[model samples]
Target chain A: MKQLTFDVAVIGGGPAGLAAALAAKEQGATRVLIIERNLELGGILQQCIHHGFGLHRFKQELTGPEYAQRFIDMVCRTDIEVMLETMVLEITNQKQIYAINQTQGMMQIDAKAIILAMGCRERTRGALRIPGTRPAGVFTAGAAQRFVNIDGYIPGKRAVILGSGDIGLIMARRFTLEGAEVKAVVEILPYAAGLTRNVVQCLDDYGIPLILQSTITCIHGKERIEGVTIAQVDQDWNPIAGTERDISCDTLLLSVGLIPENELSSQVGIQLDPVTNGPAVDSNLMTSIPGIFACGNVLHVHDLVDFVSQEAETAGCAAAAWASEKQYSSTRIIASTGKPGPCCPTSDSIPFDGVANECCATWGSTQIIIKPGNNIRYVVPQRICPDKKTTLYLRVRKPDQDVSINVGELKRMKHTFIRPSEMIKINLTPELLARHQSDYLDIHVVKEMVHHD
Target chain B: MIKTVICTVCPLSCEVELTISATNEIEKIMHNRCPRGKSYATTEHIAPRRTLTTTVHIEGAIHSMLPVRTYEPIPKELLHQVMQETANINVTSPIKMGDIIVRDILGTGVNLIATRSM
Candidate 1:
């Protein structure tokens, strides 16, 4: 086994890793190594050349590549060593990383601290369990992005995006820009899962119709996707009879969800959050294991790349602090409920009107929010760090005609419609707390009181 | 005449209602999100400049050289002129992403550079 050494090792060269490496170096970490399993750095940003990133950090509306270039340029100025086309096989609790590259077949590196910024992976068709014939035309949104943006190959002429996630909405426009006709964006949930701006710019501006409360029940194709059978779904998610419609299309793109890439985190023996399927960390972004930090999508699926950069900066500074013997003791861990939304509303109702009772379970600081079984999609605050300022994120299961989120006595943020796919963020501040600290908090979603401004 | 301009600094493109208040003195700024916007609005009222980035072809290389922007910003009206002039130029492959294609091209002491890798 080959041995190497660095003051800090950053895994996964995405925006988070790049920002982490840069921040660590700026914060006094002498030797930093960024290991990435790609021919170049920038991770998913390479495929996302669209404008939306860098608003918070650079104070400019920059494209993904442009935003990444800013950080990449910063890395070049520092003494940080970036290892491209490198893969990290495993990481140990002792801060030892096992990796491989063309130059070094297999090697071991021991560092004082390691930053896990491996990012997240897109949830695919297999995860969705969409009933379909195995065809050559189905592709993940990321794969299609790579094809069109980098490889210069359009996935298909006529496309149908099967999820209202940000990627799906962006791709709907991307395909159209490349001269492809995007028929419609079909989302099972009634509310849009993407950002409101994306819904306006990518869909509404481009005139792409968004079908809600619907799903592709069956895919029709032989060697390739010829068409699909879409149907309106009932409250139980079952397809409503006589509501099926057949649309002709050659390709299907899934932008259903994203899951944090935590395989290395698990190998390192870090305490994993059952809800997020990522590691649990404190304010400094240090994971359960000291000297090991996780940031960006690896910590949790972030809605925006700007957040990824911000979170990575925290992780990088924390890692540098750990190396310099800046110790943080007696930390009260705040658990993040994987289910995110704008409001945390609670009601003392059993077999609630539109909520799921079976999925309720307490994990750390998170509580299973109860709602009407049929209406609410997912609730956040899986656990809340009572004393600290935390944000509870949630969304409706599908788009509703009108909705209002109620969290105890506090007034909820009114929304015309809410979708489960679009994760909602609610700032939980000290003023909102009725007491210094509480054992648990209850949350729920209810019909919006009809009101107009 | 005093002109009202919007600041495009961030997503919150604040519509800045600027009152020139004649030659040196100015007041009446509104709807600005951050300090950056307010500063930009004041600066634009006096002297307007923009940062520009475009590609320059590389000799004997399949990919083009990315010439990038330098300094604060250049005049917005000169954008088309700069792009047209830079479109006809080429550079070498040893160039980095932000490498300067021309030094003080418009006598503004600002350099042109590459934006993305080819």
Candidate 2:
């Protein structure tokens, strides 16, 4: 086995890895390496051909590949090393990596810092457990996207989307443009799980029905997809008895949700937030293992790629700083040594029953724990440094009009409306956080009194 | 007549309401968080436009499909027709990003260009 050394090793050569590597290089970290599993560097962005990315970062609309190309071009201009078609098998707390590729049979990489940017995977049919015979046409919205956009093969003619997420909404339009009929986009929630722009442009533009509060109860097929049985559900998501209706379609695409690809994260025993299903890191994006950092979808699934780039860059800069100063000593990858950080960061604000794996490790003794309160689903960067200026990404549990979000006496901003689909950002300046005296910060959405003006 | 236009300029999705006079002119605009929504409502009322984004078949490329989009938003009604025209178009690889795929597509005066190099 050939052994190589790099200052920083970024896993997964997607938008996250590309941006992170670029930032690390810009931050004076030489010999940065990116390991990609695919033949190309642009991760899912290659298959995401439609525009709407880079709105925040570039202030202009850009296609996924275009957004990715800008970062790729920047990395190309630098001396950053790239290892394509390489699959990282394991990562150790000692900052060593074991990866394999066709060209390199087995290689070991010694790095001062590691960045996880593997991104997220789409939720599939097996996860849904929809009662049905094994069908050939059933596919995840992302899988269908790759097939059509990259492989140049349309999955089916008439399709029914199970989730009204951005992927499903985007694919609904894509299928329509490709001369396929998108019969309906069924979502269990009363509102769309995706952005309002996607719902308007993708479905409303094409006159595709977005059936809210409805879900596919059963999928019927023997060889290929024949049709699906959809039903309206109650508040608890239980299907109503007489609301079942059959929609005959050749394809049933599931855009249920996304899960952070944390298989390798767990392999290295990185602490994960139960709500985000990603790494539990501090304000600096540093995971439990000192030198290991996470960003982009690997940290939390972002609604936009622009946010992903912003986050990955932060992780990159932090990784570069870590590589410069190797100050960490011990490895507490074992959960028994975990600090049991703040129980669950979700709505249930109670501590765990002394379960080690259930809680994440606290970054420091003085790190303020951010807890979700009221209607807030979860807040990323579960821990924060009081003196640092930090931005906390959060999501609401439901949609509401005219609400003020309070961040532990740090700040309060009024919003015209808030929804689960749109992520809310709370900026905590050091001056504002100086007013916060508590060791833990509770973020909650509070209803303001109606103004008579 | 009143029209509620959802501003797609940003993720805020401000619901802008526009009041149109009988002379087919906008009399008042309300509820927009920014000036972009005002222009969006005016343009949407007279002639709604949309940027068409889709894939076209490409030969001699690493990937068989090439993503293309309009340089600027064309009339919203021309989207389906433009897509139909785009389906018949194919290009060879080694094309640069921003290269014109179709000039004056459907005579809508909007050029379809490649968004990424192949």
Candidate 3:
């Protein structure tokens, strides 16, 4: 193995890696190398043929490739080095990275700082534990997307997507536009986990029906996917006795969820957040190992690529600072103490022991509990420390109107808005916490408005 | 005639109503959420452009053809004409995604390029 050196080694060439490399250069890093597993530098953005990205960041509705090209062009004008078709095999505690490239064979990189921007991977059928025979027509939504958009091969004429995630929704439209019939988008959860705009623009506008609280119970086919059995699920997600229905289709696409690409991060001894299935980092986005950092979907699942770019910018600058030997002590571990509750940013199976002295000090008990309220899907920061400013994100539990969220002491933030598919963000400060001293935080939402005035 | 248009330039995609006088004089506009929407509606009600993505034959490659799209917005009505013109052309493979194939093919100053490799 040949040894290479750089000031920064970005592990993924997606939006996060591109932004990180560019930001690191702007922050005065001398040498930067970006390693990408794909043949291109855009990451998954390459397969995203839709035109809903870069609205906030670029102020234009650019397709995934267009949005990615803007950054790729900027990186080209810089001194950054991009290595495509390069896969990082291992990352060591000492910031040593081992990678393989067809041309280079085995290569080693030793950098002052490492950025884990590998992004996330789609969770497939095996991970979902779906009882079915392995069929050729079954594909993850991303894989199907690549087949239709990039590879120029139509997966099938009739399709059924099993999850209402953004990718699944976008693919529904893509498949439809490509002349394939999308039968339905079946989601196990009562609400969609994608963006509100996606549900409306990609599905509703295109006339793709969404079945809520439903799941594919079994797959039927021998040589290929011939049909699927869908059943209406109960509150506990168990299929109701007689609600099973069969839909004939040639293909099945899964958009269940995404798992952070943190195998290398974990191999390097970085603490993992089981909830986000990403690396555990502090406010600065630095991982457990000093001088190493992570951002983007690798840190947590992000609904928007613009947010991924912003997070990567922070990680890049922080990496530059760390390379300069800027040091800070994390004497206290503000962990989520107590039984790993359902919303503890960890395992959902863990039982809740409620508030305890050992609860992550970040919670501090004076904190407000931001759980999934009525018609609200899920809220982040299951427990928030009012002492420190925190931005909480929540998804609507269902399609709602005139929805108003009344935070204990704060005036109701209301308007006709919000969808189960979209996540809403609200920032809470210490000043607001001082006024509300309730032991258990209460959140009530009501729909009374027709539209936003 | 009064025209209502949806500005698909951004995610906001505001729906705007434009009132036009018989003499072609610009009149009042309502329901536009932002300044961008107002300008977009004004331009769209008169002329509309759309981005196009289609495939053309590619020779000397692993596959028969590669997907290509316009680099910028093209006149909506001319989409069929542009498609017909490119339909006969064959691009040689080893083409990178975003590599410009025809410079300003439609005279809209927008280049047509391969969207994905063969």
Ranking by lDDT: 2, 3, 1
lDDT, residue A112, model 3 = 87
Off-target runs (Cα >4 Å) in candidate 1 are A326-453, B1-114
Q: Cα deviation of A243 in candidate 3 (Å)? A: 2.4
Best by lDDT: 2
Ranking by DockQ: 2, 3, 1
Candidate 1 residue-wise lDDT, A1-453, digit = tens:
899998889998999999998889888998999999998888888677666678767766666767787888788888899888999998887889999999878989998889999999999888988897988899999999877765556889999999999899989977875568999999977677777657755787468999998999998899999999999999877899999999999999999888999988877677665556676654456665657888888887777788678678877986886676443221112112334232332324422211211111111222223222345444333433343455554545555556676665554666554555445556666566645333334455677557566
Native contact fraction of candidate 1? 0.09
Point to the candidate with the largest TM-score: 2
If chain B of candidate 1 is superposed on the true chain B, what is its TM-score?
0.75
Give the alpha-carbon lDDT of every model: 0.70, 0.86, 0.75
Interface C-alpha RMSD, model 1: 6.2
Which of candidates 1 and 3 reaches a greater DockQ? Answer: 3
TM-score of model number 3? 0.74
Q: Which pairs of residues clash in candidate 3, taking residues 3 or more apart in a chain or in different chains?
A: A335-A360, A337-A359, A337-A360, A375-A397, A376-A397, A377-A396, A377-A397
- At residue B98, candidate 1 shows an lDDT of 49
